[model samples]
Every structure is written in structure tokens, then in C-alpha cells.
Target: MHSDKAIITCAITGVLTDPGQHPVPVTPEELAREARRACDAGASVVHLHFRRQEPGKGHLPSWDPQLARDCVQALRAACPGLIINQSTGVVGPDCQGPIDCLRATRPEMAACNAGSLNYLKVRSDGAWAWPPTLFDNPPAKVKEFIDAMAETGTLPEFECFDLGIVRCVQMYRQTGMYQGLPEYNFVFGVASGMPADPDLLPILLRLKIPQAPWQATL
Candidate 1:
């Protein structure tokens, strides 16, 4: 890779994706192995989401402190220099789990879901696929997460799923909640979020703080 190439972030695991079928890691061994593979393939960072180990609960997200620390330590040993960016997303107002993980493990970076989005989907039959869930990340909650990250030396990578959420990061910067050059992820192509159109990429890029480090997460 050249010095000019954009840093690649491999999201090795995601929220609520059932590990029963998918290859997403549900244990520390798998997490470390997958992270090493991504790093060897030129990914500078790996975004991680821990899952519960209890029987039948392997699909649900977990913020267990021990799991977080074990995964981080194993990843560091396996990859040597890969960046660890832990997922801190959870629906509703209870953020203690995420906060606990952040404080306990204190990864190099953490995902800061910038705003709320009505988690939506549609069936092929022109009806709701599932009940529209409120994936809440209100200002107060965002502030709490940001403050926690600040305390732990973790850089908050704002995950903006929509245009308004993209703009909100700027507001967060101005309102003294964030004091450094912002980092952003312009997430699109979701049913209830911004469209993932090529033409819109530049437009979205233009809306962000000039020269801020950013990446496009498909």
C-alpha cells in the first residue's frame, strides 16, 4: 500500500448477525484469527462486535468485560499492529454495557452511532418485514458515549447513516462535545437511511468537515 491510499477497515463482526450460520466469530479464538487474516490482507483496522456465549444466545450482542479484554489481547498478539475498533451500538437508552466494555478494554477506537434511525425493512409482498424498531441514539446518549470515549483515550468514529446524522457530527464538534478533527463513516444503502449511490458520494463528502479522516462503509 502507498502512503496515499485510504486506510482499510474490516468490520469482522456486526450486531445481531446470527453466528449459527454465518462465519462471524462468537469466541475469542475465532475473533483473533479473523482479525489477523484481515490485517494480513491489508486492513489497517478491524471493527469488532462481541457476541454472547450462552447457549442459544450466541447471536445476541455482548459487552462482557472479560470477553472484550480477551479478544483485544488475542488480536494484539495475533496481528501485532492492527487497530481495534470496538462496536458500542445498542438500541434504547441503557448504554451501561457498552460503557463497561469501553472502560474495561479501552480499545484504540469505538463506533459512535451519531443519531437515531428507525430500523426498518420491507417484505417483497409490500408490507413490513419486521416491526419497525427504534434504534435510538439520542443527543444525550451520544454525549454520554462521547464523554466515555474521551475519558478512555478512544477516538469516536461517528457512524452517520443518513445526511442529517452526517450534519450532526459537525454540530457535535461545534458544541464542544468533540474537540478534535472529526472522523466519520458515511453509511448508506439502508432502507431507512441514505441511499448508496455513486453520485451522492462526492456530495456527502462535501458536507463533512474539510480534510477530516473518513471512510465509506457499505
Candidate 2:
């Protein structure tokens, strides 16, 4: 069976880029404006990442509860009925910033990285593009985020970057920490976890649990 309609999710801003250089929205007003524009362009949901608005701190992610509250409120007012999916994909073992923002803003959904990844990249000359650090999302950390989301009445959007992470979702469900039908975001194009190759879609689909809502984010 196939449906002609699709739910488009717009990620108005990303955490990794500097807004000044990339031209993405950084301030609350900018986010609200762009989010409304995305809704007008057929987006049913808006995935958001809050950024710092200091004079020279635009490149960094901001975890301030007030900032997140402001942005979320503006978006909700601008785009009525739009689902908000907040970003809680921080790399640290601690969930202070992400958790605080989630509890404060209380979005409809929040991203929960299902597993860890050795975030790495190499240039053509075999030189390291950046530090080969670990994007660690251990089971305990995952639980921490989940607990916060649960408290805030938010749904978890598990971000599975590789096959192993996809399988881990089942284990997480079996452990009783997760309590509902699954939601997955298959992330590709990263130099580490999984590459964005169409040839691998079948294998990835085979690895997923049947009857769960899933989508790919490149």
C-alpha cells in the first residue's frame, strides 16, 4: 500500500554550522520567520537546534532554557499546528544543557541518539579533517535524555546512524525504558557511522523493526 501524501520535516537550523557564514537562522526571530516559511512550503514539522546569540558566539550551540523557550514559543505562534522536534544530540556524557532546554520548552518531539559513533573524517591526502573524537551516546546517557523527554511529555526520535544503532533500538525498547511505538531517524552521509548510498537502503530497511515510522536525514 502507498500513500500520495508525505509529512515534510524542516530542520531550520543545525548545530554544527556558524550562522554568519552559512546564512542559517540564529536568533529567535529568525527561527520563527524561517519556520513559518518552511511550514508555508509544505512542512508539517520543524526540527530545531538553538544557537548562541552573543556578539561573537554565533558559532556555538546554546543550551539556555530561556533562549529555547523563546524560540519555541515564537515558532508555535508563527506556525500553528506545527510539530516541534527539539535537538538533544549533544556529544557529552552529561545532559545538562539539552535536558534543561527540553524541559523548559517542552517540544512535541526530541532527538535521542540511539548509539555512539567515532566521529571522524580524512582528507584526500590522508590527513585528519578534524579531531577523531567520539560522539558518545552510551545507554545510560540515552536513558538520561529519555527520562527528561518523558517528564516533559515529549516523544523520542531515535537517530540511528548505523546498523548497530538500529538494532540497539530494539534492545532499548525491551529494557522497559522506552514505552511506545518506535520512531527512527536514519542518519547518513556522515564520514563515520554510515554513508549516504542508495545501495545500502535495502540492508538498512531489512535491519529495522517492522511497522515503525522511519525517515532518512542526510
Over the stretch 1-218, how does candidate 1's per-residue lDDT look in tens digits? 45787789998876577787787887889889998889888999999998888877878888889888888888898998788998999988999999999998888999999999998999999899779998899999999999999999999999999988988999998999888888998887778988778898888888999989888888
lDDT string, candidate 2, 71-190, tens digits: 999998898999999998887887999999998999999999999999998999999988898989999999998899989999999999898999999888888878877799999988
- Cα lDDT of all candidates, in order? 0.89, 0.89
**TM-score of each predicted structure versus truth:** 0.94, 0.95
Candidate 1 residue 215 C-alpha distance from true site, Å: 0.7
The Cα RMSD in angstroms, rounded to one decimal, for candidate 1 relative to the true structure is: 1.7
Question: What does the lDDT read for residue 71 in candidate 1?
Answer: 81
Q: Return the TM-score for candidate 2, rounded to 2 decimals.
A: 0.95
